[model samples]
Target: MRGIGYSLLAAVGAWAFWPTLRDLAEKWQHDPQYSHGLLVPFFVAYLIHRKREDLKQISAVPSWPLSLLFLSTALGCRATSAIFDFLPLDGLALILVLAGAVSLIQGKEMLKTVAPALGFLLFALPLPYSMERWLSQDLQHLATLASTYLLQAIGQPAINEGNVILIDEIKLGIVEACSGLRMLMTFAAFATGITLLIDRSWATKTVLILSAIPIALIVNVLRISATGLAYVLLREAPERQNMLGFIHDFNGWMMMPVALVLFGIELKVLQWLLVEPEKLERVISFPIRREMPEVPARKAA
Candidate 1:
């Protein structure tokens, strides 16, 4: 009976969300910014798998009221997405539908247990076009500013002209493509996944997640600075354009590793600074005996 019910739910969900899923898959393939979306589903599945034991402990007592609410909201989102041609809404609707299904079939405890996995699905969805464009432009400007400062700090004659940096008479444009938004989004998602999987205090998790933004930005700035330095130092090298292009692409590929290294350092720092409550309690509860000097016995004699 449970198998039949699950089969029916899966069929209905697949049929209803086919369009949304198709669009998401295409974006993951074609959109560089959201290419990380390709890995998110697998990560979500892994998260659910990790929670299977905890899930087994919870008895299924379907919550009709909450399930109805979730399903109703999902239906409304789907309708709105269809009416307005909004893809994000479709993604939200899909998540809501999943939540509703879990609530209906496995109960609210199961829903709560799997909520993080469901929420993680949002990382796979693309931002709205307007928001993405605005953010890209802002990040481009910031990157230009930071990279120019870095070049100047290292004794290069650098000037920031809006989104372009002029150093040693070479123009490096911080185009939207170079804005580092992709790194930021990808790192943010990576951090969130790590935070979910790790058993850490909420403070540590929060710090880890928040640190993604600055780490991504810093790595991107370093990349831009290195490119500028390479251009200035090798201005007269033969096939200079080809070399610079290769450097640019290589730096882009290396950004994630650099960010990961920075994140690792952050985790170490957090570990050093933030003591767990249980450990703190043990330390406090441990007895510290102070032995009196043996001179007291001589004095008594």
Candidate 2:
């Protein structure tokens, strides 16, 4: 009976959210910045699987009030999205509906157990247009500034002018596409997923997630810098244009692996710096023996 209820709920959810899911899939396919969205569902499934035992231990106690509240909000959001033609709102409605379904069927304890996986779904949704544009511009400017400085440091006659870098007579435009926002978003999602899966202290998990930002930024900067170097080095070759194009695309593909290596290094550093509290407690509890007082006097007596 419980399984039948879940199946019916799943059917209703899928039927209602079909359009939203289609739109999300389209965005993931068309937008480079959100390509990582494609992997999010699989990761979420894995997370749920990891928590399956915990979830099984939690007994269902449906909450009528909470379920109604969430479902009503979801319906409102869905209607708003239809009126405004906003996809993000639709995505939000989907999340809320899922939450409502869980509350209705399995209750709060089950929701808490699966909250991280549910929250991870947000990464699959695209940001609002205004926010995405603003982020792109800022990232472009930062990448240009950092890349220019790096080029100068390496003895290249590079000058930053807005989002474009001038190297001698050549121009390297740090356009929206080269802004590194894609890498940042993808890496952040990856880090968060890893943090949720790993058995680590909360502090360690926090640091791991936060560290993704700087690591992503640094990797992006290196990629831009390398591209600039390649441009300079291949300036006079007959195959310069082709070589430059290849290098640019190749560096773009390499960012993730480079970021992963940096992430590993960070994990190692965190391990050295932040000993788990449980481990620390064990160390503190470890018995220490003091040297026994000399028995020479007793022997003499």
Indicate which candidate wins on TM-score: 2
lDDT for each candidate structure: 0.93, 0.91
lDDT string, candidate 2, 61-132, tens digits = 998899999899999999999999999999999999888888988899988888899999999999999999
Looking at candidate 2, what is the lDDT of residue 12?
Answer: 82
lDDT of residue 92 for candidate 2: 92
Candidate 2 residue 283 C-alpha distance from true site, Å:
1.5
> Which residue runs of candidate 2 sit more than 4 Å off their true CA positions?
297-301
TM-score of 1: 0.95
lDDT of 1 by residue, 114-197 (tens): 999999999999999999999899889999999999999999999987888998679988889889999999999999999998
